[model samples]
Target: MRTVIHKLFFVWDFDKEEKWLCDMAAKGFTLVSVGFCRYEFEKCDPGEYGVRLQLLNHRLHHPESQHYLSFLEETGAEHVGSFLSWIYLRKRTSEGAFELFSDFESRIKHLNRIILMVISIVAANLYIGIFNILMCFFYHNEANYLGFINLAIGLIGSVGIWKLLRKRKKLKNDKQIFE
Candidate 1:
């Protein structure tokens, strides 16, 4: 019973009617007796453009009920094409306390990807570090230049591991907060 801003017009109040139409359209014949207002809703009538009163119901706005909107269309309610689409606020977990576990799982997947990339890069760099040191000894027999390069690469790989350890600590702290 909520108030609706109607665009319908009676025969007596016909002059106030919209320019593009001559009969009540979306009023759906509810206003048939506005002083003999026989609804002459031609296909091109402006009343065809008004909102359907049924859409204003609270039932359609509930979180679970939003699913009905799509089902309504599928069941031949073609009129929904003109209305706004419904939204869903779905999450991976329905429970409030366990929702962060879902979030942590997503973050852990991202961390695993990063760890895989770091492992591949570090493995390649360590191989290069060992080769440079060995080449310095075997071919040129000079330790200073290649030893410094190997040491720098080793330190960079160690720093990468340290950064990953710090991120893991932060992730652990976040998971504990959820518990």
Candidate 2:
């Protein structure tokens, strides 16, 4: 049987999202598909597979991403799903463990990628919001309430960026310790 779940996970919530997917697998559901705010899972033996997710440096179709994914596949990981630049992979429990980044440096790089994506979103939102507000004032249009919506989104994204930066800082400190 297949189960579909509709949920929202912000860009900075990747760790939470990954943990939720693993918890679902522990309960006998294995992720099969992913989309904007939607996840599809198929019933499987509980604890049969280990789940891992990564934020790619490029889109799945890009040659660099394709090659990296192919490398992972050669190591016995199965590509489960992708949404935007994020990819989900699963490996049999018998494989011991599934980890996308084994070192602090690699993890830090992944965090950087996520931070950059969030920054882009924040910038776009703020720019659009300001533009709409200006237009509303000049044209005397009330329907431009979308300006407030965009500004709100920008504010939320800014919080996410700050959290990501803090996470990255911790990773860097940890890296220095092991170096």
Candidate 3:
């Protein structure tokens, strides 16, 4: 049997999303698919699988992505699903915990990739918003409403990017402390 749940989280809150997925798995709900903010879970024995989330910088159609997925599969991790640039993977708990990056340096590099992605997105949104606002002023028409909306979205993206940068900074500091 399958169950579906609806929930939304910002891209920057991926840790929270991963934790939620893991919690569902702990309760016998193995994630089968995810679209938009909805998650489809299949019934399974509690603690049957351990889940891991990864940010893939490459496009899904990229040849390197296939190689990366194949590498992970060779290591016993199953690629369950992918959305945008994020990939979901699972491994049987009996096999041990699922860890994609074992070393602190690799983990830091992964986080840096995520931070760069978020920054790029935020910059793009801001640029679009400014352009829209300029167009609205020049046209003096209904486009003003859309301009405002775009500005709001850009503001939200900026905030999200700020939060991600802070997280990245913290991770770097922690790495320094460890080394």
Candidate 4:
């Protein structure tokens, strides 16, 4: 009746995540909730629903969030769940395709926001990695293992940063097409 999936994806890869959710919906698995990197899906009629993702920087309890959720509900989108700043919504496929941002400018702005968030995370990881490396060099103890962990974190963050920057550049170049 219900299935759970564990997966991890960078925040900037939201498009991929949305596509995966849509694929699941097309296979009769409707998403019920999301916890961290876990997804809970309930079996339903195939092609019955379409999933959409919305990014809201506001806290869950914020009045702006409540108002936005209300507006989405009015538009026939059901609020399934939220993780951090991401809101998961679903709507009946028969109602037509669900798109949160209809204009090119809005899409660009959304991508810019995501890019900035990724940059901040990358910076934090880089700082921690440098600090750990310096400590390991000065202390020269068994705690050096932490330096390797930090290095890995930094590398992962750098990859995310590179991907986000490339994505932003591509979006900017393709902006004219959207216009």
Best by lDDT: 2
Question: In angstroms, how far off is 104's CA in candidate 2?
Answer: 0.6
Against the correct fold, how does model 2 do in TM-score?
0.94
Ranking by TM-score: 2, 3, 4, 1
TM-score of 1: 0.36
Off by over 4 Å in 2: none
Off by over 4 Å in 1: 1-102, 141-151, 177-179
Model 1, total clashes = 0
lDDT of 1 by residue, 105-179 (tens): 555554555555556666776777787787877787756475567657666766766676567678878888873
In candidate 3, stretches whose alpha carbon ends up further than 4 angstroms from where it belongs are none
* Number of the candidate with higher TM-score, 2 or 3: 2
* Worst 10-residue lDDT window, candidate 3: 141-150
What's the best-to-worst order under lDDT?
2, 4, 3, 1
Superior candidate under lDDT, 2 versus 3: 2
lDDT of each: 0.42, 0.92, 0.84, 0.85
Please give, for residues 108-141, the per-residue lDDT of candidate 4 as tens digits: 7888788787777767777777788788788874
Q: Return the clash pairs for model 4, or none.
A: none
Candidate 4 segments exceeding 4 Å error: none
Candidate 2 lDDT tens digits, 95-170: 8788888899889989988999899999999999989999999999877889989999999999999999999999
Residue 14 deviation, candidate 2, in Å? Answer: 0.1
Evaluate residue 130 in candidate 4 and report its C-alpha lDDT on the 0 to 100 scale: 78
Candidate 1 lDDT for residue 13:
24
